[model samples]
Target chain A: MLATMLYGPGDIRCEEVSEAKILHPTDAIIKLSASCICGSDLWPYRGANEVTAPMAMGHEYCGIVVEVGSAVKTVKPGQFVVGSFCLSDNTCPHCRFGFQSSCEQREFMTGAQAPYARVPLADGSLVATAELPSDDLIPSLLAVSDVLGTGWYAADAAGVTEGSTAVVVGDGAVGLMGVLAAKQMGAARIIAMSRHKSRQDLALEFGATDIVSERGEAGIARVKELTNGVGAESVLECVGMEESMSQAINCARPGGKIGFVGVPHGVTFDGQQLFFQQKSLLGGPAPVRRYLPYLMDLVLDREINPGKVFDLELPLADVAEGYRAMDERRAIKTLLRF
Target chain B: MLATMLYGPGDIRCEEVSEAKILHPTDAIIKLSASCICGSDLWPYRGANEVTAPMAMGHEYCGIVVEVGSAVKTVKPGQFVVGSFCLSDNTCPHCRFGFQSSCEQREFMTGAQAPYARVPLADGSLVATAELPSDDLIPSLLAVSDVLGTGWYAADAAGVTEGSTAVVVGDGAVGLMGVLAAKQMGAARIIAMSRHKSRQDLALEFGATDIVSERGEAGIARVKELTNGVGAESVLECVGMEESMSQAINCARPGGKIGFVGVPHGVTFDGQQLFFQQKSLLGGPAPVRRYLPYLMDLVLDREINPGKVFDLELPLADVAEGYRAMDERRAIKTLLRF
Candidate 1:
């Protein structure tokens, strides 16, 4: 089986890898239908996050179960499914509380950008769709494995609700999906922070009522201008850099909420700012398993087109081109066909 | 009039200062009926937070309206009242959203530990009880001015509810007040983190169902053990130190909430831990004015005796001793009578 591997910074290869096999009684082998390059992947690619060794890459996928261990009951062979980046034993107390990503027995899924992937704790991590999704729906369903669910978690953590004014502080695929989540959560106004025309257009299509192209202080000013100088009621911080996080905090009104989904890098929260500013902050991994079933329904019902984030699609063999497209900003997200 | 002045580290004095006067149309002169030393006041006294020159100390007070500016409408001469540390204009959007402490025209109240205090934005900052209270009620009413309101804000921010298990970090007056707030909010179990016998007793008296004498990791373990290894749903971080904050985070369930009210000192939020930990953090200067009216009624009805936290009482001339007692841990809280 061919899989994506990151040998070092700026080095991605699609090489033949051994086929995945069920390694535990609760594990299953999945043949991926689709996978994608993640915004977080850019970290290792840019050499900002260390890649100590040639590690198998990718943590997002929607697939068909090829084989399952005896203990895997919820999903079986030939079933189409979506699973979270974090494999979870759904029966854990944390999982029962809707925080599957932090489940007591958790394993991280990797090497998903491949012909086949092994998933542990399959019953909890994988959600089986009621019916086989159409080809068009596969990309959107694949998003539920990570980005879309992550964005949805950002909106949920931000407390988006009826008549809310939400500010999304990134223009990446997750940010666009955050706009979708805010819209679905009934926000009256969705503001997407983006400078690029392509991402802005997609943001508008995803329900962003406004776009602020400015980056730092100016970006904060634009949000304040749109929000009557009070800032948005809920802010979804999709970029985890210090500047973006600061902008997200500044763009929320006092007593407002900030839902941060980006994997933070060199970000240290200033206690004084948070205290004097009076903003509530909540976020973490998307706990995608918790929202997979619901998001799958939305994809199947055509209520949301998360797949729109995938502006570039390529065969698994051309995976490096997909990474380049995303890295060079030519694509919001790149989908890889298995 | 005499006011408490912080000259430098370990240098506190009660000296003659200019009498309080209404400098703004919205100002009112308050003849302090009762004032107390706060945990935050110790910051400058210990020289941790920079205290430049001589500055008037104290921001918590319950008093009588000695006089009011021409524009003062809600409060009048001779009314018994209590004001929050932060004066606010009630009409601002932030105030309308229940964050009076962050009101657009917010003013910090100082010199409350004096014969009188000039309260700006009096209408919004001060809450007048129905009638003059007896001497016994003064201390309790004074608690409403800060500690009690702050504690209530902590519980409110933590999302404490009936049957919820709440862990309160710190055993100071404010944290004990937090225990009281959690109890009043109907928490089925209230855990107070403390090592001192006096503070622990006071905590129990104020509604602490359990006391964890340990600190740091051991404390977190105790909380986990008590919560069936799941941790509490609501964690009130009343101490702003890194250790206490970290413990508060660790003692909460994966998706639990934390309400922090302590004036933060030397604290920087590690973004990675917060992201992976999945905790909601909300706090700052407590919007005491927003909770004053309700908290006052509870105090008046004898449902909660928040004033019991004042373990030491002294004449205003002995203000230096008051600070000394708190600094030396001889008293949990010291009430200074003008």
Candidate 2:
């Protein structure tokens, strides 16, 4: 089977790899329908993260259960399903509490940017729809595996609700989707901070009430101005840089909540300032599995077209080019069809 | 009137100062019945926080209303009241949402160690009991102004529940009171980490289920051992330092919450680690005014005796000695009788 492999920074290749099999009783073999690159993937691609061996790439995916292990009961062969980036047994205390990302018995469902992948803890990690989704809807379902789910968690953590003024502090695919999540959660005002025309348009289409082109302090000032000098009630930080984190904190009203789903890069907490502001920071690796079922419903119902984030598409063989397009900021997001 | 003043770090003096009067229309003058030094007061006294001018000492007290300005309606002369260290109008959206510490109309109450001090936002900052309690209960009532209220906020923010296990980092008055607050909040097990005999005894008396004398990594190891290697469900960080903050984060279970109320001296946030842990950090300057009423009721009902933290006492004229006692670690807390 052909799989995407990361050899080092700026070194991505699609090569024939050993076939995947159901090694564990709780595992299942999945034939990929669609997968995409994540913003987090950029870290390793940019050489920001240490990459030792050429590891299988991609964790976001939706596929058909080609084969199921003996212990896999809930997910059967021939069913269409979406699995979380982080696979979990779901029965563990952490998973039961909706923290699947931190489940004691968990595995990373990687190598999805390929023809086939092995999904562990299939019975608890994979969620199936009543019927297989059309090929056109595959991208959206694939999103549920990671980006969409993470965006949803960001909104949830920020306590976004009806009449909530939400400020999304990033313009990446996840940030645009966060605008959608905040809108679906009943946010009255959604501010998307973006300087890029493509993402700005997507954000507007996804329900951003305003846009702030400014980046750090100026961006915060613009948000405060839009919020009557009080700042937004809820802030979703999708960029994991120090500047972005500070913008999120500075753009929230005193006592407001900042739900940051971005993989924080270089940020430090200034205790005195955070304390005096009375703000709360709640987020980490998103419990994507916990929101997959509901998000899949939203996709199935066509309530939202999140798959539009995939502005560029390519065949699985051109997966390396897809990574290049995103790395160069030429495409908002790239969807690889297998 | 005599008031305590800090000329500089390690230099405290109690001397005659002008009597406080209603400076603003919303101000009320209070004749202090009892006051105490807070753990935060030691920050400046220990030279951790610089004191430039001859700053007035103390921010916690319970007093009798001596005079009220024309705008002060809810509180009148001769009413015994408990005012928060942070005097807030409690009418802004932030205060309305129960974050009085960040109230838009906030004016910090200063010189609480003085015989008389001016209290701002009298209507919202001061909460009077049904009537003045007996003299014996004065110390406990004084605590409601800061330390007790802060501890309660810590427990509340950490989401301590009836069956939850709590770990308190720091052995100061607020940390010890956090043990009491966690117990009051129905925590099943309270682990108070302290090496001080006086504080450990107080913690045990306050319903600590275990005592871990180790600090940092060793302390976190002990906490994990106590909780079957899962860490505590709730952690209260009452010491604002890098090591203490890290210990609090390490001691919390995945998906757990850390409530920090200590004035953070120097702490930075490691975004990547925090993200993977799924831990929530909630706290800032506590909204003491929001908790004073309930805390006063608890004290009135004799359900808690927070005043036990104060091990040293002196007349208002000897306020300097009180500072020295706490700074020298000879006293857990100091009380100034007026």
Candidate 3:
């Protein structure tokens, strides 16, 4: 099997590696239908996050189960399934509360960029489809595993409701999906903040009612202007940087909600400032497993086309090029084929 | 008229001051039935908050309308009313959204410890009862103006619901009110974190199901033990210091909410730490104006006895002693009479 690994800054490699195998009774082996490079992958590649050792590359995945340990009960051989980036025993208290990302037995998925990957806690982490889906739905199903589920969580956390206004602070793939989720949630106004033409076009396609190209104070001003100076009721902070977080906070009216999904690096908040701002904030790794079932149904039913976010696709062997395309802003996302 | 003033830290005095007068068309002059010292007033008295000038000492009050400006329409002479410490134009979008503290023309009420005080935005900030209530309800009605309203806001912001568990972080008058509010909201269990026996008794009287005397990690652990190792669904952070805030956050489960009403002083949050903690955060000055009418009715009906929080009663001439008692923790709160 060929798997993607990162040796150091800007050094992503695809080389022959041992096949993924079940190491625990709760584990299952799945042959990936598709995989992708997440924006977070750029952290270590850019030297922002430490690359202490050769790190396994992908977390987003969807595939068919080829083998299962005896203890795995829900998913079995020949079944199609999608799982979250954050693995968890869904029966835990946190999981039952719909915060699977913080489940007591939580673990993060890894090495999914390869043709085969081992999924732990298979019965609890994987949601199997009733029947095999058409080949055309693979990309969309893969998306429900993380990207689409995350965006949906962001919208849900923001408290977007019918006839309410929403502001998305990033124009990444997740941000575009956030626009779609807000639209589905019946938000009357969806504003996407982006400077790039391609991303803006995609945002509009995903139901963004307005686009603000400005970045800092100007961006906030434009959003306020669009909202008639009262700011949006819900704000989705898809980028975790300090500036983006500040923008997200400022773009909401008092008593509004901010759902941040980005992994923060060096962000810090003054308690007095946040108190005066008076906005509701809830951010963390999206409990993708909680939304997996409903989102997969949406994908399978063809009600949404989240796969449109994959503007670039490549073979597993060209994994490094895929990372480069997204790192260099040449692609919104890169879908890798086995 | 004699009014309380803080010349500097530990320099509180009761001195003759000019009579209150309407300075704006929206103002109303009220003859206070009673006024009280607030825990927040201790902020500047203890030098935690800067005191650069002689500051009027109180913000909690309820009284009969003595006079009204020409433009004042809702309130008039002879009507008994309760006004929030935060004055707001209720017609603004923020106020309409139920966040009166963030109203566009927001102002903080001052000189409230005096026998007569002018209230700005009278029509919007003051909620008048149909008839004058009996003297027995005066203290409770005064509590609604700030302390009770603030505690209720904390519970509301934390999303206290039927059968939910709640943890209150402070044991001051406001936190005591939070216990009452959580009880009214039907929380299955209410935990008051306090080490004082007197405060604990009041907490139990106000519907606290549990009292955790430990501070810091031990306190959080006790709360967890009581909740079956699953933290409370809602936490009311009534103490604005960093330690209390941290304790409040740690005392909640993932996806739990922390509604903080205490004015934060010199507190900061590491973005990444908060992100991984995975709890919802919403804090600010309580929008007491939004809860004023309902809370006032509860007080008038005697369904609740919030006035019990006022453990000390003093003549207005002894305002300095009242401050000293509260500052030294000798009294939970002080009621001042004209």
Best by lDDT: 3
Query: What TM-score, to 2 decimals, does candidate 3 have?
Result: 0.99
Model 1 lDDT per residue over B196-294, tens place: 999999889888899999999999999999988999989999988888888999999998999999877878888977999999999888888889889
Residue pairs clashing, model 2: A268-B269, A269-B268, A269-B269, A275-B284, A284-B275
On TM-score, the leading prediction is: 3
Give the residue spans of candidate 2 off by over 4 A.
none
Writing each residue's lDDT as its tens digit, candidate 2 over A166-279 gives: 999999989988999999999999999999998899999999999999987788888888887788779999998999999998988877889999988877777777788778
Scored on chain A only, each candidate's TM-score is 0.98, 0.98, 0.99
- The ten-residue window of minimal lDDT in model 3 chain A covers A144-153
lDDT of 2 at B238: 95
lDDT, candidate 2, equals 0.89
In candidate 1, stretches whose alpha carbon ends up further than 4 angstroms from where it belongs are: none
DockQ of each: 0.84, 0.70, 0.88
CA lDDT scores, all candidates in order: 0.91, 0.89, 0.93
The model with the greatest DockQ is 3
Better of 1 and 2 by TM-score: 1
Cα-based lDDT at residue B185, candidate 1: 89
Quick one: ranking by lDDT, best first? 3, 1, 2
